[model samples]
Target chain A: MAVREGLLALLDEGPRYGYQLKTEFEAATGGVWPLNVGQVYTTLDRLERDGLVEVRGGAEGAQSQKTYAITTDGVAALGAWWEAVPSDDPPPRDELMLKVLMAIERGDDHALKVVTNQRTVLLSLLQAKRRERRVMSDDSFASKLVTDALILRAEADLRWLDSCEEQLQTRLRAGGTTRPTRKADR
Target chain B: MTAHTLPAPNHAAVEFFDVVKRYGSGSTEVRALNGVSLRIEPGEFVAIMGPSGCGKSTLLHLAGGMEDPSAGRVYVAGRDVADMDVTDRAALRRREVGYVFQRLNLLASLTALENVSLPLELEGVGVRQARAEAREALAAVGLDHHLDRFPDDFSGGQQQRIAIARSIVGRRGVLLADEPTGSLDTATSDAVIELLAELPVRHGTAVVLVTHEPRFASWADRVVFLRDGRVVDDTARTVARSGLGAVS
Candidate 1:
């Protein structure tokens, strides 16, 4: 999501300065994403221009710290973003899927090797994530959510690879023909 | 000149001797297995892949002494299961073979620690010793903190791990997992597969798994494919390409 929307959401809580918004954003995301102070200010400036936020006050002088609050428009924008499920009209390009496709298209004995190599890499990644998830405490709820999602996605990918391998072997058994190509999957 | 042929190395952990298993009789007779003979060495992992009725489960049942062959002898850990009494067979299974059933079958009332340790305690291991082994098994499958939780409280994936922990509690020489990851999500399945792959070296256990998924077969040292109650394709090779072999 854009930092613009993020800043709006943070301001929706109440008036907060740029530094505080940056810190809260990182905290909300389990500190996995680091945000820059300059980037926060830049996004906040855009939000103000769009009339989604306004500065609260200049405490002492023109150079005094200023907090920003979300306007009605900002709240509306945040609500819309919350309810909207992001589009998946076009599937994301997956490198492993692409590699398997290329290997199959080339029509050599290399398909098994390619699939095996990719599967090995993914399995190792999955094992590490599982290990991490195992160590997660109840306090690290955000991190736990992130790791849980990761572990599920990794597993889905592995199942997809398993299906691909099964199909490939079946084709080989049926007198060596390439499978009908379909669009890449998650 | 007399030439010496090197004596064959004996490494079979479970050997099937022309085993045949048929159900029903006469016109309705269903031959679930047809003279299937195979061998699994200690510290080696093998997989059985086949269609639903190709007798993969039958083979595993025979290997674990849960079923007797209709026409042949079944040997596990160097003893003929056909010759053993009920108690002897149960004892053999307790000490040598670990079966990871498809249903998980975790005792609902027991805690994860208790469930995993139950098998060891039944085998007459001291309570303290069995609990310690249970702790290590659960930890091996990454369930350290969940030792106190019951199966009802765990996620499907976590419960599966608990099942695995229960299976490996005694460090059994042979592990027979029937569709071990069939109920798991892909990512969680990967973790289970990694653990199965490590069993040979981690606990000195031989694994004979039955999976429809070919990718899981990749983790195994051998793959035996069955069709129409007969062995169609069985291949054995080193697992260096799996990378698990090279990893510490």
Candidate 2:
């Protein structure tokens, strides 16, 4: 989704050929978001059509041989992109929360099971992310930033699961439901 | 089995064989651990997790020779704990096992250096020798500059680091930590955990941690899940990683 602005931003550094843009983009993003030559040329064509980029001679489809430079419009668009903040006006739909809600309808015991199962999966993911973070170099800010974001999100979800388990247990102890709480099937 | 009939020694740092611990007798009895068997190898980092009353603490107590089991033998450093007398057990604890509970037991009057060297001093190591080893242990936990400071002089995180330094000071073979980060905030908790993750490699000590926080448990090489006194699941990481190799 940000590929168009990414390409324009790359061009802002000066004119770059198709292959050069692809390698620089991957390097800039820590190689997490990969771009094939086809996707790069497609985005470049759109940018040229919108006047965000200009080809420096040669044929249009001959991307590798042709260089691209950001236009005045491209600079303005890139500035806007830099200033834009991601919006969360409406709460994003989360699959974990949705599954918990559906599980609650089935029963507390079922919901507890779902929470436990999800917790294990998230823990494993967090472990792997931490290991990956451990090996990263001190200067790999891009990778570190992305990895930290992911680790924090997983930790937050695990905390939510803990609360869910606590509430379920509290209700069970108070005899709030008629159904018997089954023994843990773990 | 009698101590004389014990099996041949193996390389496990600690092992619990069909161990059971119960309180009271008959109808009034409550089983804290039920036929649980586990082994922790040298330099292995294991995290024990479970709901309340799931025997996590009991498992730790047995590993440290702090309690006796009703059934099966508990071995530390390949010797049956039941075979040891009280003095031998005390020496075993002083030499082979170290514990860090939620309550940091640093004496208020002692400096960090003294607190770390006290155990060694008690075990009859020369005062100067104990102090030298204490300095190295404190340095391992990043508190070398503050060794002369009393526990009251340090922040919660620094105090925890001191407690950890005390645990590993004498080249103990096993470190049993029970909720060591229970009182710290998230960032401090992470620092404490990261220090713990390094123990196996830095000191060649096997670590057994009991924690309710999955985030902390994720740092371990293996996670053992206990339920109703029995092990429900034991998950090991796909690869074993040492803390020394991680970013500081």
Candidate 3:
């Protein structure tokens, strides 16, 4: 999703080589959106095949690199995709759920360990993202907006972790075991 | 070691001769299959059993023509698999063989009927006819009520049944099942094995299963044991040694 949007925004700036586009992309994201140079070239090749982009003449020798620019259809398609795109609330794919399910099957202390470790990791990541946001320039509104969104997501994740831990502890104490009754099984 | 002659074309559905598959070169070479040879008859329920890394799964892949043998020839229904081009081999697989993987391999988003209809759809069958045939296949497996349910909503046993329906939907000549009962509980596994046993008898589809469980092997008409890439034992054991007869 980010790749498609970033390519469209870069074309708005001007035409560029594969390597030049990759460098500019990394800089624009403050070096956070790490994209491989090979991936960039591969995606450009696909976009060309899809007729969303076109390659222009090279410097005039076999060793010269071809320059790529977005086609008119590319701009129109990208604009359509952006307008129809749903808000980015990705579904939860929690690996912890699998661990919790297994722990309930085994009826052991493993569930406590898994929840504790997840809490620690989520808290540390939230702190790191907050510190990173503090150092961003206030002058660039776009950069500040992206950073703020990322930090907000991290904060939400941290709160979720807290609630999960509390619920697990309460169940453990009340039931005298970690396993929930089969009726409540997911 | 004596070299065995290939079975007559009409007598065998699959034949393998002195096949060897090695992973790496020189000191790093790992021989996954070493001079293995076997033949499977049409309409026979055969099970290949061995300890882990004994190349049982490799043998199945070779028989199904999904992978090439490093040295020897693999024949499926009298045709040399190695000689067929990719397009022809793919056509043969689609038209003649059905595969049931240990993992259900159902597309999570599609309903049961849609998953069963995939092979026919790939063969250019129109959607209406393909869906009708898929419904018939699901009915054969007693899953008519589940035609509209997504795979994610079903239990493990039901998912396995849906996979079986998908495999046998076309009435393909050969059914290659790689540990079809691996993920189910004992009772469910027994039920699945019974269903697989009934398939060959009812549909005349040759069934070759790769499994490690002794109980599962009991369901086959014949069991061939493998060790270190060679067939070590072949037996006709009608009943499970543990005293569980064919479940009604």
Candidate 4:
């Protein structure tokens, strides 16, 4: 996500320079996303060009340190962003699903390989996310929220994997291409 | 079976491959674990989670050498229990695995120190050395002060902690615990899980915890789910992942 909306949201509170915006953004996000001051300045310049913000004092490095304030239009934009229901249209392109689909089209063992490798990787990711959430949760609600979502999603992915494996095993049984595991009758 | 230590964080301290455990025969047969493949490395924590009779306890038994597999292999600390004779398996069990059950089965007549040291003493360690190690283990779980107290004198959580201290006193390579926190309150459960979670890191003892609770399982590096004797799901995200919000 761009730091644009984040800076605008900060300006909604009060006028602040690039450095202040950067620091505030870090603080708000639990220091998870550390914003570069140069990126902050460039974003501010764009916001100014777009008339979403106005200069309160002067320019960069001024003794008074010119602050940026949200314009009336910026307020409307921030409100719109907040009110906008996030689009799920594109439906996050999952690379593993694509790989599994392609492998199954070949009618071979590659699907099993893809499923097993990804399962291990995702399992490790879930463990790590849970541990991270436990550690950082005390100080940062932002990080806790993000990690919680990650852990939930990872768990769902593992269930999906079980589904995939079951389907493959069924297919294998129908074809009489034998593997060690007996098909679970249930 | 020959028992040799596998390299830490690489080889699995406990392993199962196409494992099947069946009870009874003809007409009354029950498959407790069907073709479950798993690996838990030294310094790792794994939770076997599922509803009751889903084979969670059976899996723990397989890992800890408390039972035999009807098919496939079970490895404990690099030693294949499947190939071992009874004596060899018993030797490997004593040297490599420690079990903590749902009930804190400390001898009611014995004090906390004696309860924790009995396993060591049974393994033929001198009473002095066993008691000293048991004391340290108790201290690790914040139970050193209660050493002279008997199980009857302690709360349920304290008894459980003493059970844990007993399990780890020998520093066995694999700690197989079945519902170790089931009897505790939420806070006590969290504290017990935290202690179990720390075992692998603190003493290089791998843990295979059997829990039906998702929250308790969250402390593990991986949670393996079983259903009707089959491994339905195994989810992992290693706890060892470090850095400034790596996901971010």
Q: Which parts of model 3 are misplaced by more than 4 Å?
A: A1-186, B1-11, B236-248
Fnat, model 1, is: 0.00
Most accurate candidate by lDDT: 2
**lDDT (Cα, tens digit) per residue for candidate 1, span A1-186:** 567887788888899977889999888778777898888877887888999998888645342287889999999999999998868845877787788888987653467556655655565556456657767889988888888787778768867766676676667767886554645521
Summarize candidate 3's per-residue lDDT along B1-248 as a digit string, tens digits. 44965546586778888899778899998778899888888888888866577798888888888899998888887788998899978877877777898888999989989999998999998999989988887887778785888998888988999998888777777889999888899889878887887777777778999986545665666667665687755553213332333322
- Give TM-score, chain B, model 3: 0.87
Error at A83, model 1, angstroms: 1.5
List ranges where model 2 is wrong by over 4 Å.
A59-61, A71-76, A88-118, A164-186, B1-9, B22-35, B70-72, B83-85, B124-129, B142-146, B185-188, B237-248
**Regions of candidate 1 where Cα sits further than 4 Å from its true position:** A59-64, A178-186, B1-95, B103-172, B180-248
True contacts kept of 4: 0.30
- For model 3, residues A16-83, the per-residue Cα lDDT tens digits are 88888888888788666878888888788788888888888774533128788899888987888778
Q: Can you list the residue pairs that collide in candidate 2?
A: none
What interface RMSD do all candidates show, one decimal each?
A: 7.2, 5.4, 26.0, 5.9
The models' CA-based lDDT, in order, is 0.79, 0.86, 0.74, 0.79
lDDT of 1 by residue, B91-193 (tens): 8778788889768999999999999999999989999999999999898788899588889999888898899888878877888999989888888887888
TM-score per prediction, in order, is 0.56, 0.79, 0.52, 0.62
What TM-score would chain B receive for each of the candidates shown? 0.88, 0.91, 0.87, 0.88
CA displacement after TM-score superposition, residue A85 of candidate 1 (Å): 2.2
* Clash pairs (backbone) in predicted model 1: A155-B186, A155-B187
- How would you class the docking of model 2? acceptable
TM-score of 1: 0.56
Q: Candidate 3: lDDT of B5?
A: 56
Every model's DockQ, to 2 decimals? 0.04, 0.28, 0.01, 0.16
